[model samples]
Target chain A: MKPLMESERFVRLAAPILVGAFLIGGWELACRHWQVPVFLFPKPSDIARSLMNDAPTLLGALWVTMRITFQAFLCAVVLGTLIAFLFVQSRFLEISLFPYAVLLQVTPVVAVAPLIIILVKNTQAALTVCATLVALFPMISNTTIGLRSVDQGLANLFRMNRAGRTATLLRLRIPSALPFFFAGLRISSGLALIGAVVAEFVAGTGGRGSGLAYEILQSGFQLDIPRMFAALFLIAFAGVSLFLLMAWLSKLALGGWHESEVAREA
Target chain B: MLALNHEEAVTSHEATASPSRKPSIVDVLSANKIYADGTEALAPVDLSIAPGEFLTLIGPSGCGKSTLLKLVANLIDPTDGRLQWWRGGFDQVGGEGRRLAFVFQDATLMPWARISSNVSLPLDLAGVPSAQSKPRVAEALKRVGLEGFENRYPRQLSGGMRMRVSIARALVTNPDLLLMDEPFGALDEFTRNRLDSDLLALWWERKLTCVFVTHSIYEAVFLSTRVVVMAARPGRIYRVMEIDEPQPRGEAFRNSARFADLCRQLSAWLADASLPSPVRASP
Candidate 1:
């Protein structure tokens, strides 16, 4: 019964887009009227055209970055979860080594990227490793907390039932740890993408197989500000897409019953 | 009883628990618990559990009724005296492959498991195959009037339904003794009364020896064949009232004069217990 402009879904979709269009339209008008220098601040229209114009090259670099980010994310999830499992199994082991994990997180990835690049031999592999390190810590801490935070009453029930360690782990601890694990995935996915880009920026790899970071670097050197913006846009879009994909996966896994995933009626 | 740390009050307690027609199964001979920090959690107490007895332990908070249940459950060791089970077995329940189940204050159902799986947990832990356990799980659920809800998860159920699932889980093992620690304290009165009658039905049909812990005097009077009232501050048993009201306790029993009198008496006993001075244990 309401007008199209006033509907909830319509407003939700239209509001941000209208703001974006207004900003872009104003920028384009200012650029044309004042004849703003392209290198100083390119218009949104110029950026869009630049994206299409250099589509193959910028997109190719994006593909490389995406591959590194994906690989690093998978590695971080598996490796970090395994470490968390190990840490939970032994208190002394966790106490001895958890500080090292914190140390890895605190140390700048740029500092480690050079050392990793030097040691790993393959540039892509080194970048993946650097990204994995960046993405690893949240998974470790989140999953550790999840695994440790089993309901005490349930734990007592298991003990009363004479359930063995393996049974307890499988039936109780692992299932309880899932929501926290997925939450870790959401955070670590974004960190993984950021890690890949930062590692690429520090490595500064060139030639045919280089990533978006290198394109960004080259664009800066050539004063191709539009190209740089285009590359930056791709990275931002990919980060958002990755986050959304993780959120979707979390909902798929936990939507049926978990408190965090269940939809509440107002 | 060991003489070193335990003061033997067994003779006096044994003298009090009259040698009746009911055959004693579990004998708590001056059994008491003192924590590691030397705080007396349970003062020296004695009791006897016979088959087909519904015993409710009623007391205020920190009265160690739950601790006594744990002692019966063999979840903890007594610092003094002894808890003898089934005559010279010298073993906890399920130790010699006989089953017993403890229902906690919370439902304690696995949040991730379906109701059927939760009910089947004990059988699974006992290495009973799924094929063999299915019928039994279904039977347990049916006993609790939750037959169709086997596929539902714990979160999908209401508070009372979840507690039913917990009870079904406990019943799956066809336990000889059931230990419950305030299992209905969280529920509203309507649900609590329904569960009380349902529990009584289960008790009658199964002929189970149940040691139930609660703070509610009316609940104690309604569900129990005997109510053991306790006092706090080193947690000692103060009085034991035997409910001689006949079995198959119908709805009318709640309205009877005896029920009100029993409830009032138990309430007064509990109030007397809450007083600072330690009340003498009645014979």
Candidate 2:
């Protein structure tokens, strides 16, 4: 049983990497056989070469985009959680204000970006606002569900003890909400990155503060396809890293008790 | 059709008891429950739980046993009538020896908290600092025979162990009145019997007033001073049988012929309660 468990763990890690290698190998061979133009679709070798050559510029832009994503994610977590608490505290407030939260989520960030830029004055703050709006809904919805999903028995126990609102929220609701809140974090991290990039595209601002999206736009105008692919790769890498980071943090927080994070024998 | 008026039964149980007694901890007076959809969950029953008495409510499903327990815990208000806590109103509850604690059937420990934290929840909610509650939590765990498992999570424990932790949480509050809703109904017979004995011992040692709900007639007879058999379809009490057994009952009592006789009597009462009610049929 112990050996079988170890082998199962090995396969879980190996399977995804094996599939990735096969797909990348197929793409490289297909590009060479077709003699595709680099501008149309750069070969894997060309993308890798450009990635190394333009490392400094691409890395700086990567840093800018990531900073915006991090800031936006923090703001969303704080504000979204506050709103969720308010919603759970009063059904009337949730009924009246929830539609507006939906409206904010449904409206496209790209379409809202130009309007926000006009009003906010500062370009960075406007981009963060747009990203924050994009990332806010999951935290609010998931945390609200978590807080309200307390066990009926536990709630009765608390009431039997005459627990006050603050005591119940801190001791009972908040701890129960951890798993869902972490789930929201995983989703919001990715959305924050997406929001930042889309806002950068709509703004099209170029300067010391330009993000990877601006670099991609610049490369497109110049027909620097290999460089554009490199920028795209960096963006993909950042998004994957953010997601993994959130997952790791979730495990660290909930691994001991939560069913989702705890390892189970097959 | 077999419904006995609450007054008649209430008097019988009290009349048999010793004359010198403390005020009854809880008086559930003519309290009935009708859900929002108009299902008559309970049909206005009266019960007075005396101090240090182990009273059990037993019947088939939908007999309002759990609903009645909830009403006793004040977890839900009666749709009509009222309840008195220690001869006073609800507001006077939770004062000194007047505290109440509840044990749910599911052993509803917060999965995210350690066993120690779970046990200490009532104390924490009451604003008792960690310094004061730490020893109390340890004592409660020891009382439930779970001293070394304090740092473990709820998921790490077995079903019986989890139930013990739930019992420990109730004990940590040092409550005078303990209400349990089919707490061991889900455990295997062996584990349930073990827990039943442990619970009986706890109740004896603490002199705690307890109202327990369960579906098992044997369990009702073994652990209760008086078993209240109830019927469904406009849930109401069918009969009340006093065990007339000695205190601190154990394996010897379980193996005794007297225990078997009492169980048979309660089992027959339970079957009668589960039959379609003649009162409901006429209506």
Candidate 3:
């Protein structure tokens, strides 16, 4: 009754701007007063200057990484949803195939990156496949659980109405699986970014056309800590932004029905 | 033999008075359900609910009341006895007799859907276009007194409100028969009483046949035209009592002496149903 969203008003408008300014001011002061080595931790002002100087290069690297992450993510979503549907439909398939999915998830992507790069001649496709493998498992597992988790009473009600199998799957199971699907998507977005970076790391895709991992490697070779910090910042920012994007998508899809979204807005 | 009393007699007489009428046979018959573990969930039972009469099956837990309801709904098959419907002159497979709707005790609404969409689900499955079904959904919501809560999710609603949505969903299709397995057994005293009155109002308005299952004697007495008491351990019917009350019964009727007397009779029958089988004494 008081207002639709006083809490959101406070958090969105006041909290972030204030906290961000405070951290920057504190860092500037510490750099100015304390005799901290610039190579170890560059001053916020220096880092800003370096970021401005290397804006074009950093932006290009960001674009490359983003393209890989997005392509991998799209593939993961399609393949994961298909596999989850398959698992939900047949116990035999799930029994035979689910352990392999679990094996893929548990095995470290870094350890397999070299082998993946060796097998796939194309560098970009190899990176994409590595990222897809990393991001695919959670979507399958979460969505499968969600699809199978319908209330038995409701299922019986559907049966009593003589609902066909396709109708039940489309109207009941998929919609029921949406929240879980989004949860897996949110987790996989971050993992997708990590997957891309790690695959690039192992493949050593170094050059002007290479991603941020190559930039970090280049900066390391030239003893350019500020540039390296700038590249690292870009990676972190990309991961956070992609995660927020997934969260926003989740909100759009399930905001009206879910309590999680409702609580956030409140 | 089942004899018609005054109310049923007048109703059946009026029904037969119409010309163009055909003799109605029992739609479902001689249903028996035994689980795979050799537990006879329902003993060989016979129940013949009329086309548009309200019949409540009241009993203790594990008495196969729900099992009987499920059998008639065709959710599960009877192990022994044949459950044949009179398909004579009807185009459909099992007769054009009636479609079945079930309402559970838990108000098992899909939490991901809005109340209006949830209520319209039966129509949605029956290939009714959304545009055509919207007005019916609105009417059903209005009937349940949930007119303004169409967009609210299940989590935002109170327990009674959710149950109303469930009832509205069941009634939206104008189904021929409603199989309710203790739909209001989860509500509080005040909410349950309100829903009881509302349900009677709905039944009177629609005149659909109902087979309600409940453990509460008072609820069975207040809502049902006839309460069929069932006993456990290879469950079978213990007794059946007809409530001599008018339709659209009010809360005042629930407090009436007549209502109390019926409740007492149902309670005694239920008590007898719950008791262990007795051995003959050497007299």
Candidate 4:
């Protein structure tokens, strides 16, 4: 029983890798057997070769997109938390401004991206702003709900202690909100990457710092389907990495206490 | 028996002990609670808590025992009348010898914090430096028999241990008045008995004034110097009974025929309290 339990994590990792490998193997064989055109659907081998050959360009594009995502995510976290704090401080403020936050989330970023680029002279700044807007809502909404979800008993305990507002916020509210806040981070991190890629697509900016989206755009125009696949692969890899990073962080912060992150024996 | 003047009863009980009595630690003068929806949680009643007294308030559900406890803790304000702390306004609370602490039904420890941190919350909230609070936290945990479990999170501990942590958190303030609202209500019977025993020892050792609320008649009979039985439907005190038992009570007192008799009497009072109030036409 102990040995089987110990091997569970390994089994979890192995199962997915096996399936992915099998699928990729089948795809390569089917394409080879049919002699499919490379332009129509790039083979995995072609995509890999393209990845190796254009390593420097693809890596640079990856870095640019990642920087934008990180920047937008950081800004969204800071501003969204501040906004949530204000919302918790007063119901009047929340009622007045929460609809606008919902409005921002509902509106399509593609439509807003072009207008933002035109208004902001720096293309990079415009892209970052667009990404930030796209990523901001989940942080706001999730954090507001979290901050308000304090245990009534704990709240009364704090009150009985004569804890001032600042002490209550810092000691009680913040700790209570952490699990929900981390949940928001897991979601918003992926959204930030999506927002960055989408904004770059709308901007269509091309230069030394052009992102993976621009690389894909350029490859499409040049009919380099293998290179386009490589770019798409990089974006997918980055999105997954961002998500995993957020999950790791959430675990680091809440693993000891939160039921969501704590490991329990079956 | 409705709205018994508990102060008078307490005075009579202590008549043989001393003539120069200390002032009541708390006074509830005509204090009552009515919710926003107009549900009367408690009817206007006057009561006083003498220092170092173990007073238990027992009632059925919706009896406002919790409401009365909250009012004493000042967690919620009474909708009418007022409560006096240390025979003065709330501003005098938290003073050197006038400190108050509360234990909730749920453990209410911050799950994210280690036991030591949770226990030290009151001190930390009071801006006491860590150097000053560390020893007090250790001492409080020791009192609750949770020493050396400081680094464990609330979730890591069992329900009984978590409740001990809650008690330690209350004790860390070195409070004169301890208001506990069914602190052991969620525990198993064995654990509840153990906690009740430990709690009585603590109260005796510290000479603390306690206003404990519980549904357990035996618990009230065993622990309190005086028990205030309350009734629901515009909740109010029904009767106040004096235990007339020896101090520092233990298993001997618990197993004695006198203990059984007292418990039986309290059980009858609780049954009476649980009956629906007499209907009255709206004014």
Model 3 chain B weakest 10-residue run by lDDT:
B1-10
* lDDT, candidate 4, A112-200, per-residue tens: 99999999999999999999999999999999999999998888778777789989998889988999899999889899999999999
Q: Would you list the rank order by TM-score, best first?
A: 4, 3, 1, 2
lDDT of 4 at A222: 96
Could you give candidate 4's per-residue lDDT for residues B59-145 as a string of tens digits? Answer: 877889999998888878999999987546545533232277888899998999999999988888877889998998999999999
Task: Tell me what TM-score chain B of candidate 1 gets against the true chain B.
Answer: 0.87
- Residue-level lDDT of model 2, residues B1-283, one tens digit each, is 0121222223233333344445677898999999999999999999888877899998777889999998988888999999888546544433232267888989999998999999988888777888988998999999999989989999999999999999998888777678999899799999999999999998887767789998787788889998998989888989999887988798899999999998887777777776676442210
**Candidate that beats the other on DockQ, 1 or 4, i.e. the better one:** 4
DockQ of each: 0.58, 0.73, 0.66, 0.77
Clashing pairs in 4: none
| Model 2: colliding residue pairs | none
In candidate 4, stretches whose alpha carbon ends up further than 4 angstroms from where it belongs are A1-6, B1-19, B93-98, B277-283
* Shift in Å, residue A121, candidate 1: 2.5
Query: Against the unseen true structure, what C-alpha lDDT does each candidate score?
Result: 0.88, 0.87, 0.82, 0.88
Native-to-model Cα distance after best TM-score fit, residue A211 in candidate 1, in Å: 1.0
Off by over 4 Å in 2: A1-26, A29-35, B1-22, B35-37, B87-98, B278-283
True-vs-predicted CA distance for residue B175, candidate 3, Å: 1.8
Worst 10 residues of 3 chain A by lDDT: A257-266
Model 1 chain A — which ten-residue stretch has the worst lDDT? A257-266
Which of the CAPRI classes, incorrect, acceptable, medium or high, describes model 3? Answer: medium
Best-performing candidate as measured by DockQ: 4
